[model samples]
Target: MKINSKKVTVQKSSQALCEYLSDVKNFEALMPDNISKFELIRDDAFVFALKGMPEIALEVKEVEAPHKVMLGALSDKIPFQLTANIETINANTSQVELVFEGDFNPMMAMMIKSPITKFLETLAGNLEQIQ
Candidate 1:
């Protein structure tokens, strides 16, 4: 299954956005309001829990410098890769869209689609306020 987030324009350049995303610690600011818990487990990994979901561990899986950052689920229970796609709009502006690719049975996909989409959209929307 694949889900795409809404594109958002950010005030920073793609390089700057990617730099911020490269650090797991920096993601604390982009968390949704429903995030019940968040903890940095390593320089490139973290664990977080939403109000009603299990705490999931995620790590920075791959980074393509100023273009893309891919984070993957640390648990096989929910196999997925979330990619942050950054586009250069200008010297001081960039665009961000999140793509979530998950391996789930059709039934499981139908069950989690709504909440997952909201989660991705919230994270993408928060990119505009990255500091």
Candidate 2:
């Protein structure tokens, strides 16, 4: 399954936003307010638990400097990759997009489509505050 987040225009340079997102610790600020547990396992990995959902662990899979960062799930329960793509619009602005690719069967995909879409959009919108 593929899910794309709404694009957000951030009032910050692409490099700045990329640097902030490169560090796993900074993800706490991007998490949903309803998350009950968040733990940083290392610079590249962390685990978080959303309300009523199983704990999810993620690790940085790839980082392309000021352009993109990819995170992959560390659990067999959910095999997915979440990527953040950054485009420089100008010296003081950047456009950010989030994409989520998950290995889910038709039944699971149907069950998760709505909530996951909303979650991805929320994450993209919140990128505006990272500056």
Candidate 3:
């Protein structure tokens, strides 16, 4: 399953946003308010739990400077990759897009599509306010 978030314009430059996201500690500001637990185990790894979901470990898999950052699930329960792409709009503005790609059975995909879509959209919208 693959879901793409709506693009959002942010007041910060791509470089600034990239710098912020490059540090896992700054992710707290971008997380959903319902998050029950969050821990940064290393510079590139962390564990977090949502209101009713099992704990999930995520690791930053790759980064392309101010262009893109890719993160992947480190838990077997959920196999997925989340990518944040940043595009420079001007010296002080950027366009950001989020994509979630998950490996799910057809039945599971049908059931969680709406919720996952909403989650991705919310994440993107929240990220827009990072400046």
Scored by lDDT, the top model is: 1
lDDT of 2 by residue, 43-116 (tens): 89999888987788999999998999999999878899999999999998999899999999999999989988
* Residue runs of model 1 more than 4 Å from their true location after superposition: none
User: What is the Cα-based TM-score of model 3?
Assistant: 0.93
Q: Give the alpha carbon lDDT tens digit for every residue of 1-131 in model 1.
A: 99999999999899998998889998889999989999999899999999989898999999997999999999998999999999999999999899999999999999999999999989988987775
Candidate 2 weakest ten by summed lDDT: 122-131
Better of 1 and 3 by lDDT: 1
Order by lDDT, highest first = 1, 2, 3
Question: Where does the lowest 10-residue lDDT sum fall in candidate 1?
Answer: 122-131
Off by over 4 Å in 3: none
At residue 63, candidate 2 shows an lDDT of: 93
Judge candidate 3 at residue 14 and give its lDDT.
94
